[model samples]
Target: MSARAALATALDRIERYDEDIGALLEVDAAGAAARAAELDRSESHGALHGMPFVVKANMCIEGRIASCGSRMLEGYRAPYTASAVQRLIDEGAVPIGIANMDEFAFGSSGENSSFGSTRNPWDLSRAPGGSSSGSAAAVAARMVPFALGSDTGGSVRQPAALCGVTGYKPTYGVVSRHGLIAFGSSLDAVGVLATSAADVERVLAVISGADERDATSALRAPFEPAPARTDLRGLRVGLPREYFPADLDGRVRQPLEQALDDLRRLGAELVELDLPTTRHAIAAYYVVATAEASSNLARYDGVRYGARIAGDGSLQGMFAATRGAAFGAEALRRILLGTYVLSSGYYDAWYLRALKVRRAILRDFQAAFERVDVLAAPTSPTPAFRLGEKLSDPLAMYLCDVLTVPTSLAGLPAISVPCGCAAEDGVELPVGLQLIGPAFEDARVLSVARCYQAATEHHRRLPPLVAGGVA
Candidate 1:
């Protein structure tokens, strides 16, 4: 498709489905048309020519609102484009709009957005999984070929699992975080959501590289794509016993087992192993994530950019009033948790220990990679739960990410690919099979997902809404 044609199709999809899905917070139809026109007239093109995509709200796009899905930064325009995004633009991928996200990229359910929750396309009553909810839903609904999202913990992978699309979180330093608004500086990873693993690989090729603007960006040569895998022969796929406990939901386990069988049939050798630190991942993730969040979110105290309420004509009161008015309930909860962890006499007990646990998690992966090419597991413990199901229970909501957090904490490369569907009261929901690789094995992770998708039709299944079976 021509660039303009691609954007037209995306806009049409957004118009037909976004109102019901709540996937997009804003649509840049006119700007995208202009960029598409420029692409059509240009004689030269980059790898992603004619591609249409969206940026998660937390990522900057010059002149666009980088709201981070919170009222505090609502209407706050981005002054400069993010380094990763600019690279895509350079390669001719057009950005159609900003995708919705949890407030400050804080929540897993996407319900924390001040803008409103993004409904899952498969079932409007269900969450698409989040803070990257909109990105995953948009791709699932065919509104865009792919989109960007920031993954802290299981944000990107979890949503992609719930939404039935491919989501990839590259190694920590693979993508520059220069334009991404932070939740957890150490754990946050800019990721991608797409209709297929191959599409995701194409997008990542353009965005992954060294960036002088981001100190954390790895000083490395341009990304070299992994050779395509025709079969899984000689590939050892490790199954960590910790990832599959006796309590795993039957619906999730069934579909994942089918996928594992498919992998085995494709000639992959399944080896069982142990990652003893798996149970501590959630506790360590929250402590490390929230502590970093507290420090990163401190900039929005009504003194800097974002919402402000001048209260009682005093600076302290103004700070309190502004934060009180702008931050969402979940955002406030995390901030408090983060602050308490970083408080005097508590930092060593909480934050420091979490860091130590993070290293242990990394070591666990390193040891596993010594014996296997990749690790296979479920992305989320269950299929997409109904919206508001876990909202009232913070711990329950946090536990939903149990399976995916370990990879995030370890700063490894991982991808969630649609394995099959699980049924809930006769309604079908997508389940994801997560593939993880050691640090910097991003290409291998993507390659494995692509190979699996090549054999099975699971990733080909469409949501009811997208298939026109539902209103």
Candidate 2:
């Protein structure tokens, strides 16, 4: 199909289905169509030639509004595109628009977005997960072929799992963060959500590698295409005992166990392993992530960036007014907690201690790597939950990410692929199976996910919303 045709088709779907789902925060329809037309006239198409995609609101795109799904940046226009995004453009991917996200990438559910929560495509009453909520929902809804989201903690993977699509979080330094608005600098990663692992891999190859702009970006080998196989052969898969606890929902537990059986039948060895420090990951991740968030978010004074609110009296007054008015409740809660931990008297006690815990978690993962090629686990404790189910309880909402946060804290690469389905409220919701690899082992992780996808039709299964409307 011509680039313009593809762009047109995606735009039409968004117009038809997005009103109920709220997957996009902004739609650059004219820009995308114009670019698609131009690409159609090109003599040679790049790797992604004419494919349409979406970017999370937090990532910058020159001349486009990068709202980060908050009132603070609601009117802000980006002066430059993110390096990762620019690279994709060079390969012929046309950005459709900015997908919604938790304000400043904070909450575990999409409810934290100032623009409103993104509903799960499977069931509009349920959350799609966050802070990559909109990106995951858009892809799952087939509003776009794929989308980019930043994963800090379980922002990307959790949503992808909940949305029943493939979400790939690259190694910490593998993708540059020059344009992603900082939430947890140390834990943040630019990730991709798409219908299949191969599509994620295609985008990953284009966006991966070093950038002089981002000091933390690594000089890694660019992605190369390869043949995939379903046979596991000599691969050893580790099941972290802590990830499958007794408290896990029965719906989620059953599908994941069956997936293990599938892998076993395909010639993979499943070994149970213990990552003793897993219990402490949530506490430590919150401290370290919030501490960095508190520091990074300090720049949003009305005078410097974002929307400004006139002060009643002084400069400090203006600062407080702007942030207080612009930031959502969840964002403020995290900021307050982060500031408290980083406070003078509490820094050593809370921040420093969390760092120690982080180190221990990393070491635990490193030790596990010595024995297993990849570690597998449920992506979330349950499938998509009702939108308001955990919104009123922040602690309960945070616990939703329990299964995916440890690898995130360790800066490891992880991919979430649909393993099976669970019936919730009489609707069959998708359950994700996550495969985590050691740092920078993104390729291996994607390979395993692609192999599973090839062997099963899970990833090919579309949500009722998309499937019903598409034909």
Candidate 3:
């Protein structure tokens, strides 16, 4: 199909369905339509020619609204596009709009967005795991073929799990962070959300490479697509004991067991492994992420870009007023916590210790890799919870990422593939089987996911909200 046709379909769905999903914060239908028309007229473009996709609010696309789900930059228009996104646009992927996210990518539930929560496509009452909520939801709803999301701590994978899509977080620095609005700099990674692991791999190949603009971008060769695997012969899959807690819901566990069985039937040897440092993953991740966030966000003062509150004609008062009015409750909470951890007296006790724990987590993954080619786990502690379910309880919300933060801390590659559904009261919620790989082994992760998807119909199932889908 032509880019114009694809875009028209997406725009039609956005109009017909967005009212219920709340996945998009802004829709650039006109801009995308123009781009699609030009691409159709052009004799030659690039790979992904005429593809329609959305970018999370945090990823800057030159001249597009990039609010990062916070009121602070409510109408901010980026001067330059993010490196990863620009690569997609260059490859002929047309960006339709900015997908909603947790405010400053701070929360696990999409409800934290200042713009409003992005509801799950499977069930409107349930939350779309965030802060990549809209990215996952949009793809699941079939509004777009793919979306660009930033995963600081399973933001992309967790949402994809809840929404039943393929979400991939590449090894750190595989994609440049040039124009991604800062949030947990070290842990933050530009990720992809698509219908399947194969689709995710296609997008990754185009965008994965070194960029001169980003100092942290790896000096590596362009990503080469991998051959599709029909079977996981000789593949060693590790099952971490921590990932399956005793309190896990049977509805979720049942589907997981089925997925593991599928892997085994595909010739994968599932090996039980132990990573003791998994217990400290959450604690270490929060500390490191918040500390970096505090430093990265400090630049959003009244004197520069974004919202400003001129208070009492004083610099300090204006700063406080501007921040207080612009930042949401969750953003403020993180800022305070981050600041406290980085403070002089407590830096060693909190921030430094977190760094030590981070190292330990990385080592743990290294040790596991010696015995297994990939690690499998639940992407989120539970299936998509009710929208307001854990909003009032931050601890409960944090635990949602318990199964994902360890990989983020280790800076390894991970992808969440839809396993199956957890049948509930008149609604079928999806569960995800997460595959983690050693650092820089993204292709392996994608290959395994593709093999699993080839053998299962999970990724083929569309959300109820999408037309003709059986949920």
Candidate 4:
């Protein structure tokens, strides 16, 4: 299909289905159509030639609104396009619009968005996962072939798992973070969500590399192209015992075990290993992440970026009033938590110890890598939960990152692939099998996911919302 036709089809699906799903915060039909028309006239373009995609609202596209699903920057327009996004646009990919995300990329479930939570396409009553909620939902609902997301914790992978799409978080520094709105800058990495790992691979190829704009971006070779075959012969896969807590739901466990069997059948050897620091990951992650968030978010004071509140008060009072009015409950909660951890007396006890724990987590992964090529585990403890299910319970929501955050903290590469579905309330909710690899080994991760996807048709399965509407 031509780019124009594809854009029209995508817009039609969004209009038809997004009312209930709430996947998109904004749609640039006019911009996408104009770009598509221009591509149609050109005789030649680049790899993504006329393809349409969505970016998580946190990513800046010059002159476009990037609300990041929060009121703080509600009408903020990016003065320049994000470097990674610019690379894709350079290769002929058209940006359709911005996808929803947890406000400031802070929440685990999509419900944290100030605008409204993005519903899971599998069952509209449930959350799609987050903070890349809209990115995953848009892909799952078939409104776009792929979308860009940011993973700070399991923002990309968890949502992809819940929404039944392929989501990948490349090694930290593999993709530049020049324009991503900061949320735990140390843990944040640009990621992709799509129907298959192969599609994610293609998008990564075009955008992965160092950028001068981002000091943290590494100077590295372009990722080796994905292998042509899905064979996993002689590949070593590890199973981290900590990832499978005794309390894990059978619905999620069963599919994960079945996926392991699928990998074994594909000629991969499974090794049982231990990441001893896994249990401490969640605690350490929160301290470090929130502390950094507190530091980074200080720039958003009402005097500058965020919406200013005109209250009758002194400068200090105005700062308090503006921030109080602009930031959401979750955002305020995080900032306070962050501030407390970084306070003078508590800094050494909480913040310093968290850094030590973070190092321990990294070392654990390094030790495990010595024995295995890739590690496999469940992406989440359960399938998509009802909208309000865990929202009231902050601790429960934080635990959703239990299985996925270790890899993020270690700066390793990981991908979430739909393994199978667990029946829930008379409907089958998708469960994801996560694959983790050592830093800079993104190709192997993608190859492993592709192999599993080929042996099983899980990734090909679409939610009824899109399947039933297809003409």
- Please, what are the lDDT tens digits per residue for candidate 1 over residues 1-471? 799989988898899899999989999899999999999999998899989999999999999989999999989999999999999999999999999988998778889899999999988999989999999999999899899998889899999999999999999989999999988888889999998899888988899999999999988866667888899999999999999899899999999999999999999999999999999999999999889998999899898688999988799999989988899888898899999999999999999999999999999999999999999999999888889999999999899889888998989999999999988887889999999998888888888899999999887788877787322
lDDT of each: 0.91, 0.90, 0.91, 0.91
Candidate 3: residue pairs that collide? none
Cα lDDT for residue 307, model 2? Answer: 89
> How close to the true structure is residue 48 of candidate 2, measured as C-alpha lDDT?
95
Candidate 4 local lDDT, 1-471, one digit each (tens): 688888888899899989989988889999899999998888887889877899999999998888889899998989899999999999989999889889999887889898999999999999999999999999999888899999989999999999999999999999999999888889999999999988999899999988999999989866666666667889999999998878889999999999998999999999999999999999999898899999988887788676888676778777778888888888898899999999999999999999999999999999999999999999998899999999988889999999888888888999999999999889889999999999998998998888788889999988987788864
Model 1 TM-score on a 0 to 1 scale: 0.98
* Stretches of model 2 off by over 4 angstroms after superposition: 225-227
Worst lDDT 10-window in candidate 1: 462-471
What lDDT tens digits, residue by residue, belong to model 2 across residues 1-471?
A: 789988988999999889999999889999998899899999999999999999999999998879888899888889999999999999999998899998888887798888888999999999999989999999998888899999988888999988999998998989999998888888889999999999999999999988999998988777554568768889999999999988888998999999898888888999999999999999998998888998988999998678899869689999999999988888888889999999999999999998999899999999999999999999999899899999889899889888878988899999999988898777889999999999877878888888888788888888987787774
RMSD (Å) of each candidate, 1 decimal: 1.4, 1.1, 1.2, 1.0
Tens-digit per-residue lDDT, 67-133, candidate 3: 9999999989989899888899899999998999999998888999989999999999999899999
TM-scores for candidates 1 onward, in order: 0.98, 0.98, 0.98, 0.98
Segments of candidate 3 deviating more than 4 angstroms? 469-471
TM-score of 3: 0.98
Instruction: Give candidate 2's root-mean-square deviation (CA, Å).
Output: 1.1
